[model samples]
Target: MSETLLQLRNVGKRFGDHVVLKDINLDIAKGEVVCVIGPSGSGKSTLLRCINFIAPPEEGEVIFEGRTWKRFHSAFNFIANRKYEAKLPTLRAEIGMVFQHFNVFPHMTAIENVVLGLTKVRGNTRNVAREIAERSLRQVGLGDKLDQYPEKLSGGQKQRVAIARALALNPKVMLFDEVTSALDPELVTGILDEMRRLASDGMTMVVVTHEMNFAFQVATRIVFMDAGRIVTIGTPEEIRNTTEPRARAFLSSILG
Candidate 1:
């Protein structure tokens, strides 16, 4: 048991009368790679969002590095709301999130896009930001494409730039939301390779992915979710041998 870096206790969320996640409890330890996998509508992506407060869990505590977020009040009473807002900047700074689409700015070059977070969020000087951005881009194998605009880059390159933008922030844990789904088939391998490398380097990661092979190869543990709840948590081999019906059926569908 490594030290827990993030904890979600009894997390729950809903939109109108529809429940997306319910009583979800999970703990991620430092340097662990956890891959979340499930059928569409299983709330895998929403789980990641809740963890970062993008769409906060309506009922739960998001504890990161030992700090707890105030309980959510729908109307967000002033003092409680202010407390949440007050911590957003610092909390978000420690969580790096890469989305399904390449969310890079079209107008900015790769290096500039990566530098933006460093300068704006972390308050680094331009020269300092640039150096950090350059290093991050190079880390994701985009060194030669640093000055290229989004329009000039391939889908794979654009995704790398998005990754560099997140990496430049030096987050405690990286959240990947179906990162390779938007890429063309040929480009998926490159992105997965970079992720595998990240796992090998002991960067804590929580990934929502449909790529079973990648999950098998890189995940320290696999979380199987169904109908807004965690069906089971297991290592790749355990998942493959699971007796739980939903998980068994899901794997059969994927493996077959």
Candidate 2:
């Protein structure tokens, strides 16, 4: 088995008085693709954000590589009041995230967008970043559109560019939060196809999506979440065939 690349222990989060997550624990092995499926308000996106430190958990340990760090704590207790901090830049570099809305800079061309992070964060020279950006764009099947601006690209193309930007970081794991949810139905497949290609190439990924067919087809494990906790974790076959009440109800609702 591959080494565990990421671990979450006793993770919990709340916004004001609303609890969003509770004692969540999960381990993601290197090269494994785990898909998270749940209804809206189930904390799926919040969980992904916590992994990348976009939304720090109120209480938990987020372990990446060999180092572990607390992501958050109560502000009331002096000991726990200290803001959770770690090697954020390094950690963020190791885990690339693609948001639901393509956050690409509108002023930059596809290739330029991909090169921005490499140059700014990794401090690679412009020439080197451009070369790497081109290669990454090609990997996402966007070689011909490298010079296209965001306004000129389709939704799928823009998302692919975003993916290329993330890939340019050479991350070990990728977190995708409903990446296809905003695309038109006709454009969704192009982005998904790129994701399928990435998965086939052994890029560890954690995706939160509502597309059951895609989850069954691409993920090694499917995790179902509800009411701020994991309800089931299993292979696609187990998820489809299980008699668990939550699983059945969720499947019935989505598949209906």
lDDT of 2 by residue, 1-256 (tens): 6899999999999999999999899999999999999889999999998897888887887999979867644557655444345356677888899989989899999999998899998999999999999999998889999999999998888999999999999999999999999999999988888889889999999999988999999999999999999988998998888788987998999898
lDDT of each: 0.92, 0.90
Assess every candidate by TM-score. 0.96, 0.93
- After superposing candidate 2, which stretches have Cα over 4 Å from the reference? 72-86
The sequence of per-residue lDDT tens digits that candidate 1 reaches over residues 8-27 is 99999899999999989999
The pairs that clash in candidate 2 are: none
Error of 1 at 114 (Å): 0.9
Model 1 error, position 66 (Å): 0.8
RMSDs, each prediction? 1.4, 2.5
